[model samples]
Target: MRTFTVEIEKDEKFYIAQCVEHSNCFTQGKTIEEAIHNIKEVIDLILHIKRPKLHIILKDSLVNAL
Candidate 1:
């Protein structure tokens, strides 16, 4: 499993979320909670598109995969 850092900032009418590890990856939403959720989707999409061959076991992220 891979771990990445995310940063969130408030800008006008939305909360902007950005991946610290990926400068071009970012998303915004109406609320902080929505921003967090939207950022996850953006990150997931970026990972899938950029690392198509990457493999991960969802259930064993830290305890077992570490």
Candidate 2:
């Protein structure tokens, strides 16, 4: 089993979670926890069906500089 890190972002309306190591896999929910859970489900589905090897670019800065 492989471990993937998921990055989550929340706005006023919804939360979006995406895997840092996988592109084209993402999920949205009403809250952070929900988003994380939904993203996990998406990951499982993708892995089970397609088993794709996703390569994502690493970003050094997570926040914008003001």
Candidate 3:
């Protein structure tokens, strides 16, 4: 398992989350909760498809695997 930092921002109609470790990976939803769920799904898909290329960070700590 790998841990990555996810930054979430709220917009006018949606919440967006960007995974710091993965480029071109972002998730958006109607609500903050939905955005979090969507991001989790996106991260899982990314990890499955992209494997590993960048360093993962968690809570200001560098992580190899979650």
Worst 10 residues of 1 by lDDT: 52-61
Q: How do the predictions measure up, each by TM-score?
A: 0.67, 0.67, 0.66
Backbone clashes under 3 angstroms, per model: 0, 0, 1
lDDT of 3 by residue, 3-62 (tens): 667776656677677888776778888865686677777876867733323232233221
- Cα deviation in Å at residue 13, candidate 1? 0.5
Task: Go through the candidates in order and give the C-alpha RMSD of each one to the true structure.
Answer: 9.8, 5.8, 8.2
The top-ranked prediction according to lDDT is 2
- Arranged by lDDT with the best first, the candidates are 2, 3, 1
Tens-digit lDDT track of model 2 for 1-66: 466777766556877778877788888899666876677688879866334333332233323311
Error of 2 at 17 (Å): 0.1
- Give the clashing residue pairs of candidate 3, or none: 1-66
lDDT on C-alpha atoms for all candidate structures: 0.62, 0.65, 0.63
Cα lDDT, model 1, residue 58: 22
TM-score of 2: 0.67
Give the C-alpha lDDT of model 1.
0.62
